[model samples]
Target: MKGWRARLGFLVPPGNPTVEPEMQALAPQGVSLHFTRMTASGPAGTHEGQEERNRSQIDSIESCSALLAMVSPQVIVMAHTATSYTLGSAAEAALVARIEQLSGTRFITAFGSVLAALEHLNVRRIAYATPYNEVTTLQGKRHLEEQGIEVVSYGQLANVRNIYEENDERAYAIARAVDRPDADAVFLSGVGMPTLDALQVLENDLGKPVISAASAMMWNALRVAGVQHSHSGYGRLLS
Candidate 1:
């Protein structure tokens, strides 16, 4: 009866050290998290080969999901947001539909979850922050624009040697730095950089909602699992 209420599965990237722990922290009682890490073949931390690493991880998504499906979680979250960049906004539904059809379980992506959270919060324009390279960062902006969400402003974390090594303070800094008064919310994009701990404070300091891929994923996953969950101190989505 560990997950008698609802069990949420997460398909994570192999090198990410942030998603599982953050989701665990945000999970409500009776709801459990399960993880299946996808392939990451190219390189570990360097941005010089980040594209290759991203491609490798997404290439193995279906296989990883198939393996994860054996556990029969109510919802499976693809916890890498940038993978949607490669797949493009147009193909997002098809990918999720295909996976759900194959696995007979619901599927959601980190990027998709952010969009859902933004919509739920009635966010029109947002300030975007990320620990990704210029190419990957711009791709996220484009993907959001495709969905009718405006990126009022955006920033990338400087001197990020490895996204997985980032912590909450850095997460708080970039989110606050990119926010503008005209923006409806601040969206932190990147599953590897710890963001949940920064979410509440950023919302408090900025007087606006701060949405992150990590936080949004957990909120949406719980909703998909039919768990009526809410816990304050994280962000408005979960609270």
Candidate 2:
């Protein structure tokens, strides 16, 4: 049977094209991935007007979660990373609690999963890369610092017309450029930009852990659903 192990659900932004493909490619055997586009849109291409976009997704969460809950997925993920950045830690906690209560299923955010993955790996410092503008990129840095994860070095993609249109080669180049000798890992901090195909290659060249929002989310989703996993040829977070 499909999803014999677990059925994972994701609510992503309508403009995003990377999350489903990246996550589904890395999901374990018997684990099925289901997705629904949340009522989220704004200044497309770049993450312009993202605060409004985040709020739109938050305002629409209950209905979206309710609709997603109909499928009875073992876990539901709020797959946008910027929403957590906009909401901050305390608000995000409350949001997760409320979503869990309303959905009758556990809910996690992309940043939450990335934080869990970083903690599990004992990474104190990360070389961060994102497809956001300088403002949103610094916001993500601040978010991580608040949780005690230091961003030793960080940069955003050059002239990123749209994050969803980014390819693995660009993701790879930015990560490699931002990686630091002192950092424990390289973190690609956006769900829209593709990273799965570059994670292992980045790790090989840098000789350390490489993680993305996409990789971290899928890794944590499998764990939250009580699935035993040891995926190889991926980054350390999954293996």
Candidate 3:
């Protein structure tokens, strides 16, 4: 329960049920995780609803961050990956910097972390999968492309009401369905998806790196917090 090395604070969407558990499973011995929810509502089944929910939740970051700051965490993570599309890369960087200044903590976003993880593994072309409608999936793909990563193939579990409730088997299936032989890696987007249990298997079966939103977030948070422990059972990104 003691954070001997560093404590990490997470800002998650209100209805999300996966971020806390997944991040906790990924944390190292000396690291601890704390979470705060951002206000949001509506179904995640449709792109319009998802956008509304994301906007509503992101509006609460400033206030929620203020509360998390009182805990004095070494790092704060923005756990909602979809918000990165709301603000482009440059704008998102500025927003993170602003939050850091306000909270006096280093910050990492899910999208940014995924990008870093891909770059770290020298993965240029990726097969992307998400538990979202086609519209939201395309937005995520566009965002990645704008960041200079190629999305050679993609798939989605369209009309998913609650991504957190998705099973590990489905996550693996989606990743496999989208993957191509030419892709350097496979990316499973969304922190809400239960991806940790499937990451290692996917990588082993595909013979390449596999990265997920939750794994990427944890890796980046640990790196930023100076926790050098390399974890196994998730994937090569964390190991």
TM-scores of the candidates are: 0.96, 0.96, 0.95
User: Taking the tens digit of each residue's C-alpha lDDT, what string does model 1 give over 1-239?
Assistant: 46388878898887778877888898888886789888887656556777777788777878988888888889999998888987897677888999999999899999889988999999989999999989989988999999999999999999988888889999999988898989999999988888888989998899999989988998899888888978899988889
In candidate 1, how many clashes are counted? 0
lDDT per residue as tens, model 2, 1-239: 35289989999887888888788788888888888888867665466777788888888888888888998899999998988998898999999999999889999999999999999999999999998999888989999999999999999999888887899999999999999899999999888888888999998899999999999989999999999998887788888
> Considering summed lDDT, which 10 consecutive residues are worst modelled in model 1?
42-51
Error of 1 at 125 (Å): 0.4
Task: Give the 10-residue window scoring lowest on summed lDDT in candidate 2.
Answer: 40-49
Predicted model with the maximum lDDT: 2
| Per-residue alpha-carbon lDDT of candidate 3 for residues 8-101, written as tens digits (9 for 90 to 100) | 8999987788888898898888787899998887764245578888878778988998888888887888998888877777878898999988
State the number of backbone clashes in model 3.
Answer: 0
- Residue 5 miss distance in model 1 (angstroms): 0.7
lDDT of 2: 0.89
